[model samples]
Target: MTTAVAPPLLEDTQLGPKAGGFYRYQNIWTGLGFGIFLGFVAWLVSHATVQGSNWGTDMVVTCTMVAWVVGFNIGMGTFNAPIHWILGHDQTHEDELYAAGVGQGSSRYLKFCTDHKVVGTQYLVLVMVLFGVGGTLAMMIRTQLITPHSSFLDPQTYNAIVTIHGMVMIIATIIMVSGPFANFIMPIMIGAKDMAFPRLNAMSFWVVVSAVPCLLATFFLGGVNAGWTTYAPLSVQAPAAMDAFAMTIITFVVSVTVAGVNTIVTVVTMRAKGMTMGRLPIFTWGTVVGGALGLYAMPAFLAVMTMMITDRATGTSFFVPEVGGSQWLYENIFWIMGHPEVYVILLPPVAAVLEIASTFARKPVFGYKVAIAGFVAIAALSIMVWAHHMFTTGWAPNLAAPFMLTTELISIPTGIIFLCTIGTLWKGSIWTRLPMWFVYLFVWNFIIGGVTGIYLSDVPADQFFHGDMFVTAHFHYTLLGGAMIGATAAVCYWFPKVSGRMLNERVGKVAFWMIAIGIQVTYFGQFWEGFQGMARRIAYYNPHYETANQMSTAGAYLLMAGWLVFLYMMINGWRHGKIAPANPWHAKTLEWKVPTPVPLENFLVDPVVTSDPYTYGEGVPDGQEVPESAPAPEPELVPAGSAPGDQIDAGGAS
Candidate 1:
């Protein structure tokens, strides 16, 4: 009987690679190995072509970059599809994918796990890392600006820091709203077992992961000095690091486009039987619009990057004015995607706030249909308004009014968002929970942001404001103040649901007020500076602007402190906080129908939607349908090798 114990049921870690020869594909070490090996091969060929010349240095860069991308794909098992297809081993392997790394253990956080929840958790971790990196860069910029001259970095180094920070933060914002929420929460809310394309969903996230290291490599190479927009001949003349940035951009675009398609298909094809388009959750609608915008807008920018890279690598001079190409051409193409891309990032976080508002307000979402229509209107108008960014560039005078008008027209749809939030809270049972407080914070911040934006919408105002800090202030208010605030609210509301433990309520509220006040203090000072003739993107400034600059920098530190509190709440809350029930907030949505630490497939089976997604009110009897908050069960990722009720302990000793 002792001999028949069967080696005590080895867990994944215990079942080591010792049994499987050399290649442990699921390991991160495997990927790094592949990247280094491929980079060497590329360098050898590159060295030969540019042998004994200064070009040899840049050749090593270009070769190494290509090698990194390929190696990452291979190491992460992203190439398994092609390998399976080539071998004729029945390429349909969904069964294997569905079962891979299906657990609550931290090990699944690495190595391309196919489970949506696993992927979502991984994304949450990555997004925080990006924010930390970007925030540090921002602090550095602000630190240098605390005086009248550059103290720490040369002008060129400062420009690179700014560029890197801007790109990282932009990418982070895009991921913040859509990546984790859409992949993890949307499927469950819509009553689907998984996204329409599960494997592709996994692939999209993995590729984004692969692109990060490549982008970081830019700092070590001569860093990218051109801004994130990477306009024209300026970008073409940038050092070898610009090549790294271009490759990262292409890789990111491909990842996002894949996500865009996956989200649209999933929403269109995978909803529950009774959940029609009109009955869909507002957040779902946001996801759909965001996805559609990305689908249509990303490819044009991809073309832009390809040409930009072509100009850099082979000197074709596609954007070189010396060769008779125009800088305006690049601006036109980039902003075409650029302006809509802001809306793409903006919409989902707005929707998330709306959804969170309805839940906390204990009322139906006000003007639900109108809000959907408004999202549509904003999407349509966003593409046409890209020319507004070009107003100060001395484009055709005849086009100025039309661009200004289109830019101002965007306010109408944004107004509708304000309408939804205010109307929901008008006469409802408002729980001033940490989440709803941030909703109110958004209302205040976005109003300031939108009104300031209106000032800049006029051609004269934009021309006056364009090269100064006011435009910078306006941009930050919209993206960081609006979208980023809404995104933060989503995290607070959904953190318990995701982690199976409630965040400390007291700490959350304190964090919210600090962050909101900090942003106001920070950006408001910048607004005055902008109006004071303070130039944008410069390390040194006039002494008259120093007081405002000091104010801005101090407030930024406050913002950083607030973020640190949030990080503490999340880390401490995860391990030792109160365990939450399935429906702690007592809301009636399809997602909350399951037990905490939601089941492996979300719903045990596909649920049937019975009515409109927003059913909150005094109308539905208190006890009619929504379940009471129950005690948290011992969490497990489906209780190893047993039936539903047979929950096991962490070490499987029960």
Candidate 2:
């Protein structure tokens, strides 16, 4: 194996302003500038070739967008380390460049810093922006739906808003937990200093960042009128704005694929010496499984997009009916990846909730093995169930029965997840930390989501609910309730570790109840509208559904209010919240074992495991684990394979 050279210590001597050379390249504006220059150049070249028609402009726009992607990456210096590394060149200074200059202050957040924590923070900020925009788009949708007529936006404008909202939110959901928590916390949990490939880490983060513009670019380009799932024939006929969605997804998938490989390698190879597979923390397990799903699943979406792009730019009849193209081909590839995608969104939060549940419940996670089995089963069964999504299309009617069976069987594993969580809550003096409250909410909301999912798994019930608001509610329950709720829990739980500040508990609770209530109110109202036979993605609705639509819109605004409060809580808490010591919750995970504003190299040396990290209750012994409600022991550098660290590792013994 070619062992990657460890970069220099994360905290390096800062260069003075007088310093020249690579110091000039540390900012993101450089990337933006390069992107614009290249994009304009590409546009000119296209215009020079094509004349008179909009086709010339279309080609120019397409070429410019492609050039900008390259330029943005170039500006970020993403290509620097790779070219040097591949050619056996020295890049020792490249390490210092990422150390983020003299003060290493807030500017690091804007620059391409290689630190996992830095990259993770970047991803967090990115999602916050994306979600905020997506939320605003959603409120518009709800507003227009009120009173069953065109009001806030015209029908075409409404379609564009809906399409943009749907697509951005899907990307947001995919990255919400996985990008932030996994990037920041996983290596820490596995006892590694950084990800297996730090450069790849920065690239993964910035690539996603670079793609954001293209996603939003659809708004001005005649709009992406198709739903988030552009599908075939429809996507083929979509306006030029659809190209932006395709590029956004395609770029995001590349990021996912890159990050996936890096995460898997980190876990498999970088665990603290004795932290065996069985000893791995639940969140680490979640990261690995989620990463694996992304590694395998996202490429399929990329393939679908690539072909779709080709169909547009080259006049290839890939999806055109008259020229021997097949629409089913696109749907098959998309859903094949799509079904596993929910699990990809879901697993990290599931792992996170599982972790929080055990700590706050004052118990070891009940059925750790069963939860692991559940993860395994969910991943194994997820691929087979994609066709359950296709039942409504009637593309392959005969296959529906087998797909339905696999879909229902998935419930057995999911049921195990519920079993483990509920079992942990049983008979324990549950300490409801602000974060843990959301974990419990995740359980409740997910139950509704899951049971409804089972209902939809069957062909007959799906026939009833397929095209309506019921479908929307079901997924919102799962995706929002599962991923978003859990991400909030994780942020609350780990805020201290990330920001070195304690989150305001009362504030979190208020935001939580408001958002949770808003979610239930909004989706359940939509559910009733669905029962009244309301179809989604339309500007106008039937007069019979006015009350429910109005109610749903009101609830939607409420949800938006809650999110604003939540955003306020996060920002205010970070800037002025109380300073927290290392382990505020007294959790026993390896991350909590570290000190505040964690150093570049996570630990002085890697941690080794002697026993499971989640040892609850006394085994009639004095010092077996980091006890509940005990003040955290002060952290210090311990040598690898040495005394104090060994003792610390074994201290969590059962």
lDDT of 2 by residue, 30-108 (tens): 9889887887887788778765654444555577678888888888777776676698965655354444332567777
For model 1, residues 518-630, the per-residue Cα lDDT tens digits are 89888988998998989888987889999999989888888888888888888888888799888877766677776678665665434554466566644744221222322
TM-score versus the correct structure, for each prediction: 0.90, 0.92
Error of 1 at 271 (Å): 0.7
- Each candidate's number of clashing pairs is 1, 0
Among residues 3 or more apart in sequence or in different chains, the pairs in candidate 1 whose N, CA or C atoms overlap within 3 Å are 470-530
How does each model score on lDDT? 0.78, 0.81
TM-score of 1: 0.90
- Any idea what lDDT model 1 has? 0.78
Sliding window of 10 residues with minimal summed lDDT for model 2: 622-631
